[model samples]
Target: MNNQIDTLCTESWSCFKAYDIRGRVGEELNEQKAYAIARAYAEVVKPKQVVVGADIRLSSKAMKAAVCRGLVDHGVDVIDLGMSGTEEVYFAVQHWQLDGGIEITASHNPADYNGMKLVGRDARPIGENNGLSDIHKVAVQGHFDNCLPQGEKLTKGCLSEYVSYLVSFINPDNIKPLTIVTNAGNGAAGHAIDAIESQLASLGVPITFIKIHHEADGHFPNGVPNPMLPENRAATTQAVIEHQADFGLAWDGDFDRCFFFDEKGQFIEGYYIVGLLAEAFALRQQGAKVIHDPRLYWNTTDILASSGGQPILAKAGHTYIKQMMREHDAVYGGEMSAHHYFRDFAYCDSGMIPWLLVAELLCVKSMSLSEAVEKRILAYPSSGEINSHIAEPHKVLSKVKAHYSRDAVSIDESDGISIEFEKWRFNLRPSNTEPLVRLNVESRGCQSLMEEKTTELLSFLDR
Candidate 1:
């Protein structure tokens, strides 16, 4: 493959996306580029040791190795966690008491793409405003003096610890007998699922798993493993349909964020899952606050409040949400985009947590996933999430805001613009990574008004 290193990145650095870096592999990222990034990262963080992991992508393993080489050259010790997800690597960083960590995966991007997500000592995000700017400058230079004459390499695996902690959160002993379909999408989550399922089986839980595409096929012949796409999720949905399973589960490339498909072949939003988790956490830590972003639904707010946990809203990004969880000492936090952070796990988000919680919810209660979500679905009907491209982003946002920002209702620009009304509210914000704007509308349990307001807003955009 052509290495894009030792070259000027003139593509507006859009590849350095919102929360982490991702792009087309050859054109945007390659070994040379990864080396510079790793060297730059070593210089900026100056961490004594860095933990590394990657997905099942063919290039991901090499990309991670190159990064380790760069770090070791920079006189930084490397702790290699072979074949793991992003969150599992993050947990290793915390569990190992290392300085920071790097996860070599492109998240849900296509097979041709790959990237990295960096974290500080506490398993925090290194966003653009944070240390990313310094790292970018170092990467641009592609030369570093921190390269040591020689360094040491340590190989360790966090799979067992990660699985132990996840099982600790829920009792596999109490798990109910249920037929479930889990789709790993040929990513790095197979090993993890294997270990966890073994534990479940040992506990005598009758979880009949109809596993789909569980192998680590880097070719991704079945398209990107991102269940967010209707096409990519077809296999999981089909499994649920054919097997008549209780529900379907899906995870991204690194398994940090999970997606679900109900038995009826319907994709469920991450927002509702947040509410369900809030319920679980509340039961454990009564009156503990839950953090949520202002997107799609207020189900989180309602769930936390009814459960006696305070609900605080933050901007919709991993960095912002993580900071909020720390500030408020929240028991849990979630965004509509499927990122869920937990204070119990050192204020880091885990893709494994949601599935474990789902299993526990099933084991403890007699309710199906759909049955549990019925009341909240009726309370806050949303327009899901809509994305639109605009040549003039600022102008369009201002136009939308001008129409509502000055109204009698309260307005917020925390993450985006949320013009609140008694019966309906809408949030419009530009995405940090994509060239499109994100729009969400929800009503106070009013279906007609939601349709009317959504139509009106789209009409405005149409004009």
Candidate 2:
């Protein structure tokens, strides 16, 4: 290995994770490293043109500039989308027919963190198994051949087109006139929400939007925009109750994953939302196939079966979900972590489309958001994902498997160890992003049983 590559590997290989590149801004990831990675990516993918976008992180601009420079130096034409969400890069690549795309974003990570997500033609992901590893190898080498003619760079705005496409997912005339609360949590979501609201007004849709933390502040004055945390959801939940809104919505830093709230100020789990959206899409296109992650299963599978739709289980991750959706030509795919993928959207996950579909579902069904998902929740009670930071995750998984093997009616390890019994099932998998083990348990119409299994599993993992 080259001395530079040796240095990077020894010092800060933490930036290169399983699915995407992420790390602390200046310490682990910097402009020079960003440039090296982009050059390596260009060398590996050899794309004629690439779309580049950045989030509102303070370091994103410089990082994006370095990446663009590297791509341009390699004779790859660059279409810069300026500050944008991760999905915008996906949209731009497919919409503009670019050869590849890159988004400089760390999603819901702290303000001090930043990263990059890459996609090939058709917005196909380049994760660890495919091109990311190659990029890492080439990046560490840090050597690039000279190009006689450097590539050209052009800047463009994609917000309007993206917003129009988002609104096209649902019929504006059929949507009910309801007040909805939206919290951007001071992330990049504010821009898209504002644009969508403007487009809705122009189309004369009588929807009222209540906004909070609607500014793009990198300091994260409100908190990181991850609604998965109970504390971070209080603002959106409270706003829904105070404004008497039909429902509430929030998005992470890059606006790729969105979370939902009910009319009664209750936060909805992403697992149930998967079922709800699956049913919605199935109602529109009968016999449509829906893809879901392996972490939580019963609710989504049951809903798909009842809706006359095919349900496919994919290993959990954006790259795997998108690849499976394309392979099966599935209409929609969702993960419990709020990543919702659509066939219509280049098989890319969007934080914007889920809430739009939910709103339209409420309007057409004449049911409140709570009422829409209550049946599914009661039918399959889940102990939302519980994470524990343990030193020996693999050993713990092996122990858990050994303990449950005999009792489990069926066992599988597509993504992790998933054991199923007569009435309940649980999945214990090591997290890809963090040093932790994530546990997800669900029961058949038994909340108490779900709780019991969750407690038991926690005890086993903790011990």
Candidate 3:
């Protein structure tokens, strides 16, 4: 087995990323790589038992089987959670108190790509800084124990319990009669939605679902389920408008992040959703702590202040957000990228939880999604994140800072350059994986100022 790994893996693996493993299937990530990664995880994490699941991608099952084989060969017991979302693996790990878990998914990447998300006990993320680097090293070295007894595998499920757990976030009885449009985009979200819908029906919650692109197809006939893209959002928006629904929801390939659209088919910015969820948490528990990314946060901070919640800022990405949440014991954490994390769910993000809470908030507040966020949008108008490609990202960041730093009220580089003024602020962050810089600008009650600043930053970056 060791010789097989050494012969098969002659080159350094390219699938390892800053947060998780992801790459093109055949060229970068294959069954052999998956097997090596699994063995590496067994060696590094040393978990006695692990839970594994795969998304609907065509390569996922084979990747998952290779992973399982490696784990079993390492004498690590495996719990199989056949075709499921990334969050399901998270749920299974924490709910069952397993040692670790992995989900075979590329998560909104193109059809030709596939990868994995890994977590340890309590569903703690295993990213590059923590354990992923070590795992990568071990996989490349191809060293393993040859004396341990082979372990066994078991097939189990938690769909019903997972549905119940999702429902427990909100009082189902409080849900008012409403029509909702849900677009799964041929991802793994459809099954979970169906299960949740059935559970809500059994609980007598009167919510009608108008589902579109709700089948699991690895070919992605409707396109990849990335609602974050402008082109991918039209179908979900049109569904809401055509159905005359109260609101709409959408999820990515692995269903870890959820996106929302208002009744008027206008897609809500994820920043506003963060504010809404922060307010909801604050209302539920006075002085609740909330974690937010450091991109565009005037509205989030303002809402937290008025709602009596403490807002903690963290660098963007799941691993950093989860660490900050654990550090502060925050009740909830949100990223403007539609990732919502909760304390109750082992500090893990869930595509299912965010929409459920938004639905309940709608019923309780008796306001449309647009109405709920309109005032905040007006008060703290923002330029949604805009990405610009650059050959040298560091030079661009330095130029932006050098230009703005002297007159800036304050400058922060915890994540990237965040320059603040009395009335407006902007964050220019370089991408971890690509030659791009993402800029987000916001101004106090000044949409025009935000737009002007956004344009100015882009123009400067282009130079």
Candidate 4:
């Protein structure tokens, strides 16, 4: 046992990141390390009953089993929801009132990578500050105390219930008959979409779904299943244009974030979707509080104000956003990265709910998705997040601040450095998970101004 522990501890703990566990599958996160992580999590969290799920990764099954063994060994009963998106585990934890939950997934990483996302009761994320740090420390130590009697494992299928819960977010009768293209990117979203479609059909909802890359292939034959990348969006855009669909939708590996494309096959910036959804929820319940990240704002803030809702700005990560949502009892929260959080859905982000609400909005407004977003797009044009790899992100940020602080109308450094001028503004922040610095520029109804500012910021950052 000592020799085994020594071997496990020798592996790099880099897989345990700020928000969740993630790394290359074999080298950094094989079965032994997975077992150690689960054991460490069990020791730290000490939950009586936990829910576990995995994405359709080639290594996920083995990892899942190893995690379950560690949890069960620690006398924690495990509710296994086999092959699921991260959101499913979130749903199961809250819906079933489990003590905690863990989903084994690397979420849109390459096929060679796999990891885990952990949550406690009510689906609150276990992040670095909250519990992930302790987990990392204990995981590195690779030591655990075994229980006298191992806990039993059980399998639970929540897809039907999960689909039903998702459908309840919007009235099916209000969803108009429409042709839509959905690109699953050959990940776990296809199955969820299928289940939702079945439920919609049962309710007599007339919706046409043109599915692309629908298979859950762990090999990711169609690239890495990430829709954020421009190159990855080509197939979905082309399919939407070829099918002449109303709009298009795409999801990453674990389907936590969803992306949208207009009828013209133009990729809609996620910044606009945050405003759209905020407006939708605000109109449904007037004066509702909406939470938005500080990265890209004006549009969302304007929409919320115009719709008689309060806008609260939170930090840019899921963990921070979820915490803010609960604090303010916000109706919804969104990040420009396409993660949408619903208070009704236990403040966890869902790729599924955003589209449902958007579809409902299209029906009620009697407009195409493009028409719905066109006004907002023109009102607040933006440069979608531009990431630059830099050795000294902080130094570059300071340099940019020094250049603009003199002329800036307002400057804020809550998550990153955000400088505002009269007509245009930009935010430059280091990524929470990666070494790159992300820059976002937006102007008040001025596309050219946004372009100029984005280029200017890149010039400073590139140096």
Per-model TM-score versus the true fold: 0.94, 0.97, 0.97, 0.98
After TM-score superposition, the amount by which residue 424's alpha carbon in candidate 1 deviates from its true location, in angstroms, is 1.1
Model 2 regions lying over 4 Å from their true place? 1-10
Give every collision pair in model 2.
Answer: none
RMSD of 3: 1.4
Candidate 3: residue 7 lDDT (0-100): 68
> Tens digit of lDDT per residue, candidate 2, span 1-463?
2775567556665789888999997898998899889889999999999999999888999999999999998989999999889999999998889999999999988888999999999999999999999999888777778643799999987788888999999999888799999999888888899899999999999989999999998889998888888899999989999999999998999999989999999999999999999888887788999999988979988888888999998999999999899999999999999999999999999999998888888998899989998998999999998889999898988888899999789999988899999999999899887777899999999999999989988887778
Please list all clashing residue pairs in model 3, or write none if there are none. Answer: none
In terms of lDDT, the poorest run of 10 residues in model 1 is 1-10
Candidate 3 lDDT, tens digit per residue, 328-422?
99999999888999999999999999999999999998889999999999999988878788888888889889999888999999998999999
Instruction: Rank the candidate models, highest lDDT first.
Output: 3, 4, 2, 1
Candidate 4 lDDT, tens digit per residue, 1-463? 7987898777677887778888897787889888888888888988999999999999999999999998898888999999999999999998899989999998978899999999988999999999999999898888788644798899887999999999999988898788899999989999999999999999999999999999999988899898988999999999999999999999999999999999999999999999999998898898999999888999999998889989998989889999999999999999999999999999999999999999988999899888998999999999999889999898988899999999999999998899999998989999876678999999999999999888877887777
Prediction 2 TM-score vs. true: 0.97
Tens digits of per-residue lDDT for model 1, 365-462: 87888887767878887777777787777787788888876653777777767788877899888887667788888888888888888888888876
Positional deviation of residue 364's Cα in model 4 after best superposition, in angstroms:
0.6
RMSD from true fold, candidate 4: 1.2
Task: Quickly count the clashes in candidate 2.
Answer: 0
Better of 1 and 4 by lDDT: 4
